[model samples]
Target chain A: MNQFIQELTKGLWKELPPFRLLLGLCPVLAVTKSASNGIGMGMAVLFVLTLSNMLISLVRNIIPSKVRIACFITISATLVVAVELLMQAYAYPLYLQLGIFVPLIVVNCIILGRAEAFAAKNPVHLAIADGLGMGLGFTMSLTFLGSIREILGAGTWFGYPVMWDGFQPFTIMVEAPGAFLCLGLTLAAMNYGTRRQLMKRNREGSEASASPCGGCRACSIGKSQD
Target chain B: MSVFEVFISAIFVNNIVLAQNLGNCPYLGCSKEKGVALGMGTSVIFVTVMATLCTWLVQKYILIPTGLEYLQTLVFILIIASLVQFVEMFLKKAIPPLYASLGIFLPLITTNCCVLGVTLLVQREQYDLMDALIYAFATGAGFLLALLLMAGVRERLETCRVPKAMAGTPIALIMAGIMSLSFMAFKGMV
Candidate 1:
């Protein structure tokens, strides 16, 4: 239980997918024109990520090391297809809004990255926790970014007008460039916060500050190779 | 649309990276060094065009005929994965020097949403074979163009003083945002 909570909370803030780990960025930049769209995309990803992680963890021992990646891709692709059908039937409008990004979720690095790094080694319950945590983190980040863009870009949040009548929307906030700029600035702010925290910890002469990459299993794997 | 117009629109008006927002992983990951960026761009061009051609045929002959259109995502991804593997093996044996330069990036291409995105886009737009091929090529070229420009800027960024918090990916992303804004100017050209 303790381990599960640890795994769960880590994804929430310590190893947040888009903002911190920087995985699965394509959809992050593309589908975030409004807060609702962000929630929609987040829900789809949450479904796939949680289920795929559970499935992969259950079969970890059966999968050959050499063929694991192909297996992972196949599993996620199937889930994404299920998501497409479900969205088409129930959420047709959002299906159209998200468009190619729905299918593109199959290639999202966060899903694949977690499958390879966390699920393949952990038990099913822990894997579920990790997936749930990561999925929620991803959804929160997307919604936050989307809300900022939508409120500023369209003078609305979740499609409701929030700004004064004469407020001029920064139309660029909803465009491709604004997505990049907003995300860039958000990441920088996060970094600033982390830096200040580290400095405060050091001034107290506490135990050495944890490495930013300490919680990032993916980067650790890459570093081990080098 | 005319072939010329499709080609121009793909490269400028609807650039795969700048306009469509696909393949950003490679756009940011590989653009730090000019040489790596060039290699990655070339390999993307080679794989995207080939994958488009093969997937187009598969969609026409197999998926459409069998009424398995619902399986489009699964089948396209499988085909692309296998296609990239074959291309990597063929390049390694037939063209050693080219393989040496592009070797590392080939496997990464399997997961690149750009290749799959282009194949799906052409089908969505109902482009004929010739138009599909040209569009795929032009899209790849646009990606290359964006990456090269970004690489040049990053190389220069190395010497400048950057804030501690915005030193690496943050600053690079802001730069990409600015570049994307400039690319928006081309919207009127086509």
Candidate 2:
């Protein structure tokens, strides 16, 4: 249970897919024109990631090591097709909105990375937890970035107008260039926050233990002590 | 659209990397060095055109006739994966220097969305065989153009002072954004 929670929470912030791990960037940049679009893409990814992780974990023992990647791609590709069909049936509009990205999910790297790194080695339950965590983390990041772009770019939040009538929308915010700029600034801000927190931790650790490592999180030396 | 128009629009207006946002992993990953970018771009051109042709034939003969169109995602990806492996082996045996230049990047193309994306796009657009090939070649060239431009810029960026936090991917993304903005100038040209 403890390990499951650790796996789950790590994806939320510590290893958030787009911001931290920097995986699956194509969807992150392309589909984030609006908050709803982001959530939609995220949900599709969540569905594929969770089920693929579970299936891969269940069959981990049977798959040959040399052929594991091909196996993983096959599994995820099947799931992506299912996702495409399901979306077409229930959410036809969003299915069209997402377009080719739905199929492109098979190559998202986050799904393949998790399958190779976690699901292949871990048990089913833990793999499920990791997938759920990473999926939710990816969803949260996409929604957050999407909301920022939508609000600034179109003066709306999730299809509803939020800004005053006088507001002049920065149309570029929801365009191709805006996606890159917004993500770049967001990553920088996150890094700055992390650096500040690490510095504070280092100061406290120095006063308490006179440690030689200075409690820097970037290195593994201080991690074991913590 | 005319084949000539398709070629022009693909290379400029709807560039795979800057405009369409496909194959970003390699666009960023391989663009740090000019030579690697050149190698990656060339390999992508070769693989994408071949993959598109294969997928198009399979779609026309196999999936559509068998009514297994819903399985398009699964089948196309499998074909791409196997095709990439075959290409790698063929290159290693027939053209050692070309294989050496491509190196590991050849295998990585199996997963690059641009190849698959182009294949799927041509199908979605319902292009005939001739148009499909031209479109694929043009999209690949667009991707190559974007990658080379980015590599040139990033090479210069290496000598510049960047803040610690935004030193790597963040700054690279910003540069890409600027390049993308410039590419937008070609929007009306098509």
Query: In candidate 1, which residue ranges exceed 4 Å CA deviation?
Result: A207-226
Native contact fraction of candidate 2? 0.60
lDDT of 2 at A176: 91
Q: Residues A103-189, candidate 2, lDDT per residue (tens digit)? A: 999999899989988999999999999999999999999999999999999999999999997999999888898988898888778
Residue-by-residue lDDT tens digits, candidate 1, A1-226: 9999999999899888888788888999999999999999999999999999999999999999998888999999999999999999999999999999999999888889899899999999999999999999999999999999999999999888999999999999999999999998998888888778887787899987587532323233222110
lDDT of 2 by residue, B17-38 (tens): 8888888777777787888888
| Inter-residue clash pairs, candidate 2 | none
The 10 consecutive residues of candidate 1 chain B with the worst lDDT sum are B163-172
Model 2 DockQ, alpha carbons vs. true complex: 0.46
Worst 10 residues of 2 chain B by lDDT: B163-172
> Scored by CA lDDT, what does every candidate get?
0.90, 0.88
| Candidate closest to the true structure, highest TM-score | 1
C-alpha positional error of residue B162 in candidate 1 after TM-score superposition, expressed in Å: 1.2
